[model samples]
Target: MRIITGIYKGRHFDIPRTFKARPTTDFAKENIFNVLNGYIDLEDAIALDLFSGTGSISLELVSRGCQSVISVEADRDHHAFIKQCLKKLGTDRCIALRGDVFRFIKSCHQQFDFIFADPPYALPELPTLPKLILERGLLKPNGIFVFEHGKNNSFEDVPGFIEHRAYGSVNFSIFSNREPEGEDE
Candidate 1:
Protein backbone atom coordinates (compact mmCIF):
# COMPACT_ATOMS: atom_id res chain seq x y z
CA MET A 1 0.00 0.00 0.00
CA ARG A 2 1.04 3.64 -0.47
CA ILE A 3 0.66 6.83 1.51
CA ILE A 4 -2.09 8.70 -0.36
CA THR A 5 -1.28 12.31 0.64
CA GLY A 6 0.68 14.78 2.71
CA ILE A 7 4.41 15.10 3.40
CA TYR A 8 4.89 11.35 3.19
CA LYS A 9 2.83 10.91 0.09
CA GLY A 10 3.93 8.35 -2.51
CA ARG A 11 5.72 6.16 0.05
CA HIS A 12 5.09 2.43 -0.32
CA PHE A 13 5.06 -0.54 2.03
CA ASP A 14 4.42 -4.18 1.36
CA ILE A 15 2.00 -6.28 3.36
CA PRO A 16 4.19 -9.07 4.61
CA ARG A 17 3.55 -12.45 3.02
CA THR A 18 2.70 -13.75 6.46
CA PHE A 19 0.19 -11.05 7.13
CA LYS A 20 -3.41 -12.18 6.77
CA ALA A 21 -4.91 -8.82 7.63
CA ARG A 22 -7.28 -7.24 5.13
CA PRO A 23 -6.47 -3.69 4.15
CA THR A 24 -8.88 -0.91 3.26
CA THR A 25 -8.86 -0.36 -0.46
CA ASP A 26 -7.31 2.76 -2.01
CA PHE A 27 -10.70 3.90 -3.29
CA ALA A 28 -12.30 3.72 0.13
CA LYS A 29 -9.29 5.30 1.78
CA GLU A 30 -9.29 8.31 -0.51
CA ASN A 31 -12.94 8.92 0.19
CA ILE A 32 -12.55 8.46 3.92
CA PHE A 33 -9.76 11.00 4.12
CA ASN A 34 -11.74 13.39 2.01
CA VAL A 35 -14.50 13.27 4.58
CA LEU A 36 -12.04 13.60 7.41
CA ASN A 37 -10.48 16.65 5.79
CA GLY A 38 -13.75 18.45 6.18
CA TYR A 39 -14.05 18.02 9.96
CA ILE A 40 -10.63 17.20 11.28
CA ASP A 41 -7.83 19.57 12.11
CA LEU A 42 -5.21 16.93 11.59
CA GLU A 43 -2.41 18.60 13.52
CA ASP A 44 -4.40 18.85 16.73
CA ALA A 45 -5.77 15.34 16.84
CA ILE A 46 -4.75 12.22 18.71
CA ALA A 47 -5.77 9.10 16.83
CA LEU A 48 -6.32 5.49 17.76
CA ASP A 49 -6.42 2.82 15.11
CA LEU A 50 -7.77 -0.45 16.49
CA PHE A 51 -7.72 -3.78 14.69
CA SER A 52 -5.08 -1.86 12.80
CA GLY A 53 -4.39 -4.50 10.16
CA THR A 54 -1.63 -3.21 7.88
CA GLY A 55 -1.81 0.24 9.53
CA SER A 56 -3.09 1.95 6.41
CA ILE A 57 -5.41 4.20 8.38
CA SER A 58 -2.75 5.12 10.90
CA LEU A 59 -0.24 5.98 8.24
CA GLU A 60 -2.84 8.03 6.43
CA LEU A 61 -3.58 9.94 9.64
CA VAL A 62 0.09 10.52 10.24
CA SER A 63 0.61 11.68 6.68
CA ARG A 64 -2.13 14.22 7.08
CA GLY A 65 -0.42 15.63 10.21
CA CYS A 66 -2.20 14.10 13.17
CA GLN A 67 -0.18 14.92 16.28
CA SER A 68 0.10 11.32 17.41
CA VAL A 69 -1.30 7.97 16.44
CA ILE A 70 -1.48 4.69 18.34
CA SER A 71 -1.89 1.68 16.11
CA VAL A 72 -3.10 -1.53 17.74
CA GLU A 73 -2.74 -4.90 16.11
CA ALA A 74 -2.64 -8.45 17.47
CA ASP A 75 -0.92 -10.41 14.76
CA ARG A 76 2.83 -10.40 14.95
CA ASP A 77 3.39 -9.86 11.27
CA HIS A 78 0.78 -7.20 10.96
CA HIS A 79 2.16 -5.33 13.95
CA ALA A 80 5.67 -5.62 12.61
CA PHE A 81 4.59 -4.33 9.25
CA ILE A 82 3.23 -1.18 10.92
CA LYS A 83 6.48 -0.59 12.74
CA GLN A 84 8.35 -1.18 9.54
CA CYS A 85 6.26 1.39 7.76
CA LEU A 86 6.78 3.97 10.49
CA LYS A 87 10.49 3.45 10.41
CA LYS A 88 10.59 3.69 6.65
CA LEU A 89 8.58 6.87 6.69
CA GLY A 90 10.89 8.22 9.40
CA THR A 91 7.83 9.06 11.45
CA ASP A 92 8.47 9.23 15.16
CA ARG A 93 4.92 10.45 15.62
CA CYS A 94 3.25 7.06 15.74
CA ILE A 95 3.20 4.22 18.24
CA ALA A 96 2.60 0.66 17.18
CA LEU A 97 1.36 -1.78 19.81
CA ARG A 98 0.89 -5.52 19.53
CA GLY A 99 -2.12 -6.67 21.51
CA ASP A 100 -5.67 -7.93 21.29
CA VAL A 101 -7.94 -4.97 20.46
CA PHE A 102 -10.66 -5.90 22.94
CA ARG A 103 -8.20 -6.30 25.80
CA PHE A 104 -6.41 -3.16 24.82
CA ILE A 105 -9.62 -1.19 24.80
CA LYS A 106 -10.51 -2.29 28.33
CA SER A 107 -7.04 -1.43 29.58
CA CYS A 108 -6.59 1.92 27.92
CA HIS A 109 -7.65 4.95 29.94
CA GLN A 110 -6.40 7.81 27.83
CA GLN A 111 -8.83 9.56 25.49
CA PHE A 112 -8.33 10.38 21.86
CA ASP A 113 -9.70 12.98 19.49
CA PHE A 114 -10.44 10.28 16.94
CA ILE A 115 -10.75 6.51 17.12
CA PHE A 116 -11.08 4.14 14.19
CA ALA A 117 -11.94 0.47 14.58
CA ASP A 118 -12.13 -1.94 11.66
CA PRO A 119 -12.66 -5.28 13.28
CA PRO A 120 -13.19 -8.51 11.41
CA TYR A 121 -16.65 -8.38 9.83
CA ALA A 122 -17.46 -11.93 10.78
CA LEU A 123 -16.76 -11.39 14.47
CA PRO A 124 -20.01 -11.95 16.34
CA GLU A 125 -19.33 -9.21 18.89
CA LEU A 126 -19.02 -6.49 16.23
CA PRO A 127 -22.20 -4.76 17.30
CA THR A 128 -20.88 -3.82 20.74
CA LEU A 129 -17.83 -1.77 19.82
CA PRO A 130 -19.52 1.62 20.02
CA LYS A 131 -21.11 0.81 23.35
CA LEU A 132 -17.85 -0.45 24.74
CA ILE A 133 -16.07 2.73 23.67
CA LEU A 134 -18.71 5.02 25.10
CA GLU A 135 -18.85 3.12 28.38
CA ARG A 136 -15.11 3.45 28.74
CA GLY A 137 -15.02 7.16 27.79
CA LEU A 138 -12.40 6.53 25.18
CA LEU A 139 -13.45 9.41 22.93
CA LYS A 140 -13.04 13.04 23.89
CA PRO A 141 -16.17 15.11 24.42
CA ASN A 142 -16.38 16.06 20.75
CA GLY A 143 -14.39 13.30 19.18
CA ILE A 144 -15.34 10.79 16.53
CA PHE A 145 -15.18 7.02 16.35
CA VAL A 146 -15.38 5.42 12.94
CA PHE A 147 -16.09 1.72 12.50
CA GLU A 148 -15.31 0.16 9.13
CA HIS A 149 -17.18 -2.95 8.13
CA GLY A 150 -18.51 -4.92 5.23
CA LYS A 151 -21.75 -3.89 3.52
CA ASN A 152 -23.85 -6.57 5.20
CA ASN A 153 -24.13 -4.73 8.54
CA SER A 154 -25.64 -1.35 9.38
CA PHE A 155 -25.34 0.70 12.57
CA GLU A 156 -28.25 3.08 12.03
CA ASP A 157 -30.16 1.78 15.05
CA VAL A 158 -27.26 2.05 17.43
CA PRO A 159 -27.27 4.98 19.84
CA GLY A 160 -24.51 7.59 19.35
CA PHE A 161 -24.38 6.61 15.69
CA ILE A 162 -24.36 9.90 13.78
CA GLU A 163 -23.70 8.98 10.18
CA HIS A 164 -23.04 6.01 7.94
CA ARG A 165 -21.28 6.17 4.59
CA ALA A 166 -20.63 3.59 1.93
CA TYR A 167 -17.88 3.50 -0.65
CA GLY A 168 -18.52 0.61 -2.96
CA SER A 169 -18.36 -2.64 -0.96
CA VAL A 170 -16.56 -0.94 1.93
CA ASN A 171 -18.75 0.69 4.56
CA PHE A 172 -18.09 3.06 7.46
CA SER A 173 -20.26 3.90 10.44
CA ILE A 174 -19.48 7.21 12.11
CA PHE A 175 -20.23 7.93 15.75
CA SER A 176 -19.82 11.45 17.08
CA ASN A 177 -20.13 13.47 20.29
CA ARG A 178 -21.54 16.73 18.97
CA GLU A 179 -25.23 17.51 18.92
CA PRO A 180 -26.50 19.02 15.72
CA GLU A 181 -27.26 22.71 15.54
CA GLY A 182 -30.83 23.76 16.59
CA GLU A 183 -31.32 20.60 18.62
CA ASP A 184 -33.18 20.57 21.94
CA GLU A 185 -31.58 22.05 25.05
Candidate 2:
Protein backbone atom coordinates (compact mmCIF):
# COMPACT_ATOMS: atom_id res chain seq x y z
CA MET A 1 0.00 0.00 0.00
CA ARG A 2 1.04 3.63 -0.48
CA ILE A 3 0.70 6.96 1.30
CA ILE A 4 -0.81 9.13 -1.43
CA THR A 5 -0.11 12.66 -0.21
CA GLY A 6 1.34 15.12 2.28
CA ILE A 7 4.68 14.52 4.04
CA TYR A 8 4.59 10.81 3.33
CA LYS A 9 3.43 11.08 -0.25
CA GLY A 10 4.53 8.25 -2.51
CA ARG A 11 5.73 6.17 0.43
CA HIS A 12 4.89 2.46 0.18
CA PHE A 13 4.62 -0.40 2.63
CA ASP A 14 4.77 -4.06 1.82
CA ILE A 15 1.96 -5.79 3.69
CA PRO A 16 2.62 -9.39 4.58
CA ARG A 17 0.79 -12.05 2.61
CA THR A 18 -0.57 -13.55 5.82
CA PHE A 19 -2.61 -10.44 6.55
CA LYS A 20 -6.30 -11.03 5.99
CA ALA A 21 -7.30 -7.42 6.37
CA ARG A 22 -8.13 -5.69 3.11
CA PRO A 23 -6.50 -2.30 2.75
CA THR A 24 -8.31 0.45 0.91
CA THR A 25 -7.52 0.81 -2.78
CA ASP A 26 -5.10 3.66 -3.42
CA PHE A 27 -7.36 5.09 -6.11
CA ALA A 28 -10.40 5.20 -3.88
CA LYS A 29 -8.45 6.53 -0.94
CA GLU A 30 -6.96 9.34 -3.01
CA ASN A 31 -10.32 10.36 -4.39
CA ILE A 32 -11.92 10.26 -0.96
CA PHE A 33 -9.28 12.56 0.44
CA ASN A 34 -9.57 14.87 -2.53
CA VAL A 35 -13.24 15.32 -1.75
CA LEU A 36 -12.60 15.69 1.96
CA ASN A 37 -9.96 18.33 1.38
CA GLY A 38 -12.65 20.61 -0.01
CA TYR A 39 -14.65 20.48 3.23
CA ILE A 40 -12.21 19.82 6.08
CA ASP A 41 -8.81 21.12 7.00
CA LEU A 42 -6.76 18.06 7.74
CA GLU A 43 -4.11 20.01 9.63
CA ASP A 44 -6.54 20.79 12.42
CA ALA A 45 -8.51 17.58 12.54
CA ILE A 46 -8.48 14.95 15.26
CA ALA A 47 -9.24 11.62 13.62
CA LEU A 48 -10.29 8.09 14.45
CA ASP A 49 -9.82 5.01 12.27
CA LEU A 50 -11.77 1.86 13.06
CA PHE A 51 -10.88 -1.66 11.97
CA SER A 52 -7.62 0.01 11.00
CA GLY A 53 -6.30 -2.53 8.58
CA THR A 54 -2.63 -1.98 7.89
CA GLY A 55 -3.16 1.49 9.43
CA SER A 56 -3.21 2.94 5.91
CA ILE A 57 -5.87 5.55 6.52
CA SER A 58 -4.47 6.41 9.92
CA LEU A 59 -1.04 6.85 8.47
CA GLU A 60 -2.42 9.00 5.70
CA LEU A 61 -4.16 11.17 8.29
CA VAL A 62 -0.91 11.72 10.12
CA SER A 63 0.90 12.37 6.89
CA ARG A 64 -1.63 15.04 6.02
CA GLY A 65 -1.05 16.70 9.40
CA CYS A 66 -4.13 15.76 11.39
CA GLN A 67 -3.75 16.99 14.96
CA SER A 68 -4.00 13.47 16.32
CA VAL A 69 -5.25 10.03 15.35
CA ILE A 70 -6.44 6.96 17.24
CA SER A 71 -6.38 3.72 15.28
CA VAL A 72 -8.16 0.60 16.56
CA GLU A 73 -7.59 -2.84 15.15
CA ALA A 74 -8.94 -6.16 16.44
CA ASP A 75 -6.42 -8.62 15.14
CA ARG A 76 -3.08 -9.36 16.80
CA ASP A 77 -0.80 -9.35 13.76
CA HIS A 78 -2.60 -6.44 12.21
CA HIS A 79 -2.10 -4.40 15.35
CA ALA A 80 1.59 -5.25 15.42
CA PHE A 81 2.05 -4.18 11.82
CA ILE A 82 0.32 -0.89 12.53
CA LYS A 83 2.66 -0.22 15.43
CA GLN A 84 5.69 -0.89 13.29
CA CYS A 85 4.38 1.45 10.62
CA LEU A 86 3.82 4.20 13.17
CA LYS A 87 7.32 3.81 14.54
CA LYS A 88 8.84 4.15 11.10
CA LEU A 89 6.76 7.22 10.35
CA GLY A 90 8.42 8.89 13.36
CA THR A 91 5.35 10.75 14.44
CA ASP A 92 3.85 11.02 17.91
CA ARG A 93 0.46 11.99 16.52
CA CYS A 94 -1.07 8.53 16.17
CA ILE A 95 -2.01 6.07 18.92
CA ALA A 96 -2.53 2.48 17.78
CA LEU A 97 -4.63 0.19 19.93
CA ARG A 98 -5.26 -3.54 19.64
CA GLY A 99 -8.88 -4.32 20.55
CA ASP A 100 -12.38 -5.03 19.35
CA VAL A 101 -13.75 -2.08 17.31
CA PHE A 102 -17.23 -2.37 18.77
CA ARG A 103 -16.03 -2.47 22.36
CA PHE A 104 -13.75 0.48 21.78
CA ILE A 105 -16.58 2.52 20.32
CA LYS A 106 -18.81 1.73 23.29
CA SER A 107 -16.22 2.84 25.84
CA CYS A 108 -14.76 5.79 23.98
CA HIS A 109 -15.57 9.14 25.54
CA GLN A 110 -13.48 11.38 23.37
CA GLN A 111 -14.90 13.00 20.27
CA PHE A 112 -13.17 13.44 16.94
CA ASP A 113 -13.25 15.83 14.01
CA PHE A 114 -13.04 13.00 11.50
CA ILE A 115 -13.77 9.28 11.74
CA PHE A 116 -13.28 6.44 9.25
CA ALA A 117 -14.40 2.84 9.54
CA ASP A 118 -13.60 -0.01 7.13
CA PRO A 119 -14.96 -3.17 8.64
CA PRO A 120 -15.12 -6.52 6.89
CA TYR A 121 -17.93 -6.32 4.31
CA ALA A 122 -19.53 -9.53 5.56
CA LEU A 123 -19.66 -8.47 9.20
CA PRO A 124 -23.27 -8.57 10.41
CA GLU A 125 -23.01 -5.46 12.59
CA LEU A 126 -22.00 -3.22 9.70
CA PRO A 127 -25.36 -1.56 9.29
CA THR A 128 -25.45 -0.42 12.91
CA LEU A 129 -22.14 1.43 12.96
CA PRO A 130 -23.29 4.79 11.64
CA LYS A 131 -26.16 4.95 14.11
CA LEU A 132 -24.06 3.77 17.03
CA ILE A 133 -21.47 6.46 16.45
CA LEU A 134 -24.02 9.18 15.81
CA GLU A 135 -26.23 8.31 18.78
CA ARG A 136 -23.26 8.04 21.12
CA GLY A 137 -21.97 11.44 19.94
CA LEU A 138 -18.54 10.12 19.15
CA LEU A 139 -18.24 12.77 16.44
CA LYS A 140 -17.98 16.39 17.52
CA PRO A 141 -20.26 18.97 15.97
CA ASN A 142 -19.68 19.21 12.20
CA GLY A 143 -17.44 16.17 12.35
CA ILE A 144 -17.39 13.84 9.35
CA PHE A 145 -17.55 10.08 9.35
CA VAL A 146 -16.54 7.97 6.36
CA PHE A 147 -17.67 4.36 6.41
CA GLU A 148 -16.24 2.08 3.72
CA HIS A 149 -17.93 -1.06 2.52
CA GLY A 150 -18.58 -3.25 -0.49
CA LYS A 151 -21.16 -2.68 -3.26
CA ASN A 152 -23.88 -4.57 -1.35
CA ASN A 153 -24.41 -1.80 1.25
CA SER A 154 -25.93 1.66 1.05
CA PHE A 155 -26.51 4.41 3.64
CA GLU A 156 -28.79 6.76 1.71
CA ASP A 157 -31.66 6.38 4.18
CA VAL A 158 -29.41 6.71 7.19
CA PRO A 159 -30.18 9.87 9.21
CA GLY A 160 -26.77 11.47 9.25
CA PHE A 161 -25.72 10.37 5.82
CA ILE A 162 -24.54 13.34 3.77
CA GLU A 163 -23.37 11.68 0.58
CA HIS A 164 -22.24 8.44 -0.96
CA ARG A 165 -19.22 8.09 -3.24
CA ALA A 166 -18.15 5.09 -5.22
CA TYR A 167 -14.87 4.08 -6.87
CA GLY A 168 -14.94 0.79 -8.67
CA SER A 169 -16.25 -1.70 -6.08
CA VAL A 170 -15.39 0.47 -3.09
CA ASN A 171 -18.26 2.38 -1.52
CA PHE A 172 -18.06 5.20 1.02
CA SER A 173 -21.01 6.60 2.89
CA ILE A 174 -20.20 9.99 4.36
CA PHE A 175 -21.97 11.37 7.43
CA SER A 176 -21.87 14.61 9.30
CA ASN A 177 -22.53 15.09 13.02
CA ARG A 178 -24.20 18.44 12.56
CA GLU A 179 -27.64 18.46 11.00
CA PRO A 180 -28.80 21.66 9.34
CA GLU A 181 -31.00 23.91 11.47
CA GLY A 182 -34.74 23.36 10.91
CA GLU A 183 -34.16 19.98 9.33
CA ASP A 184 -36.25 17.09 10.63
CA GLU A 185 -34.67 14.95 13.29
Candidate 3:
Protein backbone atom coordinates (compact mmCIF):
# COMPACT_ATOMS: atom_id res chain seq x y z
CA MET A 1 0.00 0.00 0.00
CA ARG A 2 1.07 3.62 -0.47
CA ILE A 3 0.55 6.93 1.28
CA ILE A 4 -0.94 9.00 -1.52
CA THR A 5 -0.32 12.54 -0.31
CA GLY A 6 0.72 14.93 2.40
CA ILE A 7 4.11 14.72 4.13
CA TYR A 8 4.25 10.95 3.54
CA LYS A 9 3.22 11.10 -0.07
CA GLY A 10 4.50 8.20 -2.15
CA ARG A 11 5.55 6.20 0.91
CA HIS A 12 4.94 2.50 0.46
CA PHE A 13 4.37 -0.45 2.78
CA ASP A 14 3.39 -4.07 2.39
CA ILE A 15 0.63 -5.86 4.24
CA PRO A 16 1.58 -9.23 5.66
CA ARG A 17 0.35 -12.08 3.48
CA THR A 18 -1.48 -13.55 6.44
CA PHE A 19 -3.65 -10.50 6.83
CA LYS A 20 -7.25 -10.46 5.69
CA ALA A 21 -8.17 -6.79 5.85
CA ARG A 22 -8.35 -5.06 2.53
CA PRO A 23 -6.72 -1.69 2.35
CA THR A 24 -8.28 1.04 0.27
CA THR A 25 -6.94 1.37 -3.24
CA ASP A 26 -4.49 4.22 -3.77
CA PHE A 27 -6.58 5.66 -6.61
CA ALA A 28 -9.73 5.81 -4.53
CA LYS A 29 -7.89 7.14 -1.50
CA GLU A 30 -6.34 9.93 -3.59
CA ASN A 31 -9.66 11.02 -5.02
CA ILE A 32 -11.33 10.94 -1.62
CA PHE A 33 -8.56 13.09 -0.13
CA ASN A 34 -8.90 15.54 -2.98
CA VAL A 35 -12.49 16.04 -1.99
CA LEU A 36 -11.67 16.22 1.72
CA ASN A 37 -8.86 18.67 1.03
CA GLY A 38 -11.39 21.12 -0.34
CA TYR A 39 -13.35 21.26 2.91
CA ILE A 40 -11.45 20.27 6.04
CA ASP A 41 -8.45 22.09 7.48
CA LEU A 42 -6.68 18.83 8.32
CA GLU A 43 -3.91 20.41 10.39
CA ASP A 44 -6.02 20.61 13.54
CA ALA A 45 -8.67 17.99 12.89
CA ILE A 46 -9.16 15.23 15.47
CA ALA A 47 -10.06 12.12 13.57
CA LEU A 48 -11.13 8.53 14.15
CA ASP A 49 -10.58 5.66 11.75
CA LEU A 50 -12.76 2.58 12.30
CA PHE A 51 -11.76 -0.84 11.05
CA SER A 52 -8.38 0.65 10.36
CA GLY A 53 -6.99 -2.00 8.06
CA THR A 54 -3.29 -1.59 7.66
CA GLY A 55 -3.80 1.84 9.23
CA SER A 56 -4.00 3.22 5.72
CA ILE A 57 -6.48 6.06 6.24
CA SER A 58 -5.18 6.77 9.72
CA LEU A 59 -1.69 7.26 8.39
CA GLU A 60 -2.97 9.47 5.62
CA LEU A 61 -4.83 11.61 8.13
CA VAL A 62 -1.69 11.99 10.19
CA SER A 63 0.51 12.74 7.20
CA ARG A 64 -2.02 15.36 6.10
CA GLY A 65 -1.59 16.99 9.52
CA CYS A 66 -4.59 16.00 11.61
CA GLN A 67 -3.94 16.96 15.21
CA SER A 68 -4.57 13.40 16.35
CA VAL A 69 -5.82 10.18 14.81
CA ILE A 70 -7.27 7.24 16.73
CA SER A 71 -7.24 4.03 14.74
CA VAL A 72 -9.31 1.06 16.00
CA GLU A 73 -8.89 -2.35 14.52
CA ALA A 74 -10.28 -5.52 16.06
CA ASP A 75 -7.74 -7.94 14.68
CA ARG A 76 -4.67 -8.26 16.84
CA ASP A 77 -2.33 -8.80 13.95
CA HIS A 78 -3.73 -5.89 12.01
CA HIS A 79 -3.47 -3.69 15.06
CA ALA A 80 0.16 -4.68 15.55
CA PHE A 81 0.95 -3.92 11.94
CA ILE A 82 -0.63 -0.50 12.32
CA LYS A 83 1.56 0.24 15.33
CA GLN A 84 4.62 -0.85 13.38
CA CYS A 85 3.65 1.41 10.52
CA LEU A 86 3.13 4.33 12.88
CA LYS A 87 6.55 3.71 14.40
CA LYS A 88 8.13 3.56 10.97
CA LEU A 89 6.48 6.85 10.08
CA GLY A 90 8.30 8.33 13.07
CA THR A 91 5.30 10.36 14.23
CA ASP A 92 3.45 10.63 17.50
CA ARG A 93 0.17 11.84 16.02
CA CYS A 94 -1.70 8.56 15.79
CA ILE A 95 -2.91 6.23 18.51
CA ALA A 96 -3.40 2.68 17.40
CA LEU A 97 -5.95 0.72 19.38
CA ARG A 98 -6.69 -2.98 19.29
CA GLY A 99 -10.38 -3.24 20.03
CA ASP A 100 -13.80 -3.68 18.61
CA VAL A 101 -14.80 -0.64 16.58
CA PHE A 102 -18.39 -0.87 17.77
CA ARG A 103 -17.44 -1.04 21.41
CA PHE A 104 -15.14 1.92 20.97
CA ILE A 105 -17.92 3.81 19.24
CA LYS A 106 -20.43 3.08 21.97
CA SER A 107 -18.07 3.93 24.80
CA CYS A 108 -16.26 6.89 23.30
CA HIS A 109 -16.95 10.12 25.15
CA GLN A 110 -14.99 12.51 23.02
CA GLN A 111 -16.32 14.11 19.86
CA PHE A 112 -14.31 14.37 16.69
CA ASP A 113 -14.04 16.66 13.70
CA PHE A 114 -13.92 13.76 11.28
CA ILE A 115 -14.67 10.02 11.35
CA PHE A 116 -14.14 7.33 8.78
CA ALA A 117 -15.51 3.78 8.87
CA ASP A 118 -14.49 1.04 6.46
CA PRO A 119 -16.03 -2.04 8.03
CA PRO A 120 -15.95 -5.30 6.19
CA TYR A 121 -18.69 -5.02 3.58
CA ALA A 122 -20.20 -8.26 4.76
CA LEU A 123 -20.61 -7.08 8.31
CA PRO A 124 -24.23 -7.32 9.44
CA GLU A 125 -23.95 -4.06 11.35
CA LEU A 126 -22.72 -2.03 8.40
CA PRO A 127 -26.09 -0.48 7.63
CA THR A 128 -26.63 0.71 11.17
CA LEU A 129 -23.35 2.53 11.80
CA PRO A 130 -24.58 5.89 10.56
CA LYS A 131 -27.49 5.90 12.96
CA LEU A 132 -25.35 4.61 15.77
CA ILE A 133 -22.84 7.40 15.34
CA LEU A 134 -25.55 10.03 15.02
CA GLU A 135 -27.56 8.76 17.96
CA ARG A 136 -24.43 8.72 20.07
CA GLY A 137 -23.51 12.27 19.07
CA LEU A 138 -19.96 11.26 18.37
CA LEU A 139 -19.35 14.02 15.87
CA LYS A 140 -19.21 17.68 16.75
CA PRO A 141 -21.45 20.13 14.92
CA ASN A 142 -20.47 20.38 11.26
CA GLY A 143 -18.26 17.33 11.65
CA ILE A 144 -18.06 14.82 8.82
CA PHE A 145 -18.27 11.04 8.61
CA VAL A 146 -17.21 9.12 5.57
CA PHE A 147 -18.48 5.54 5.24
CA GLU A 148 -16.90 3.26 2.71
CA HIS A 149 -18.80 0.21 1.59
CA GLY A 150 -19.45 -2.04 -1.33
CA LYS A 151 -22.22 -1.32 -3.86
CA ASN A 152 -24.63 -3.57 -1.97
CA ASN A 153 -25.50 -0.75 0.43
CA SER A 154 -26.96 2.73 0.13
CA PHE A 155 -27.23 5.48 2.77
CA GLU A 156 -28.63 8.43 0.84
CA ASP A 157 -31.82 8.49 2.86
CA VAL A 158 -30.10 8.37 6.19
CA PRO A 159 -30.13 11.62 8.15
CA GLY A 160 -26.83 13.54 7.87
CA PHE A 161 -26.04 11.87 4.59
CA ILE A 162 -25.11 14.67 2.26
CA GLU A 163 -23.34 13.08 -0.69
CA HIS A 164 -22.28 9.87 -2.32
CA ARG A 165 -19.22 9.18 -4.41
CA ALA A 166 -18.18 6.09 -6.27
CA TYR A 167 -14.60 5.26 -7.11
CA GLY A 168 -14.72 2.17 -9.25
CA SER A 169 -15.91 -0.68 -7.03
CA VAL A 170 -15.49 1.27 -3.83
CA ASN A 171 -18.37 3.48 -2.73
CA PHE A 172 -18.32 6.24 -0.14
CA SER A 173 -21.32 7.82 1.57
CA ILE A 174 -20.56 11.11 3.28
CA PHE A 175 -22.52 12.51 6.18
CA SER A 176 -22.23 15.79 8.04
CA ASN A 177 -23.60 17.25 11.25
CA ARG A 178 -23.78 20.76 9.83
CA GLU A 179 -27.05 22.47 10.52
CA PRO A 180 -29.04 23.46 7.49
CA GLU A 181 -28.92 27.14 6.59
CA GLY A 182 -31.17 29.66 8.39
CA GLU A 183 -32.68 27.34 10.99
CA ASP A 184 -31.10 28.38 14.24
CA GLU A 185 -34.32 27.91 16.18
Query: After superposing candidate 3, which stretches have Cα over 4 Å from the reference?
Result: none
Against the unseen true structure, what C-alpha lDDT does each candidate score?
A: 0.88, 0.92, 0.91
| Best model number under lDDT | 2
> Candidate 2's residue-wise lDDT over 1-185, tens digit each?
99999998888899999999989999999999998986678896999999998999999999999999999999999999999998988989999999999899999999999999999999999989988988988998889999999898888888888899999999999999775688666
Candidate 3 backbone collisions, by pair: none
TM-scores of all predicted structures:
0.93, 0.96, 0.96
The residue pairs in collision within model 2 are: none
Model 3 has how many clashing residue pairs?
A: 0
Write one digit per residue (lDDT tens) for candidate 3, span 16-47: 99999989998899898888776567788999
Q: Residue 62 CA error for candidate 1 (Å)?
A: 0.8
Report the alpha-carbon TM-score of model 3 versus the true structure.
0.96
- lDDT of predicted model 1: 0.88
lDDT of 3: 0.91
**Which 10 residues in a row give candidate 2 its minimum summed lDDT?**
176-185
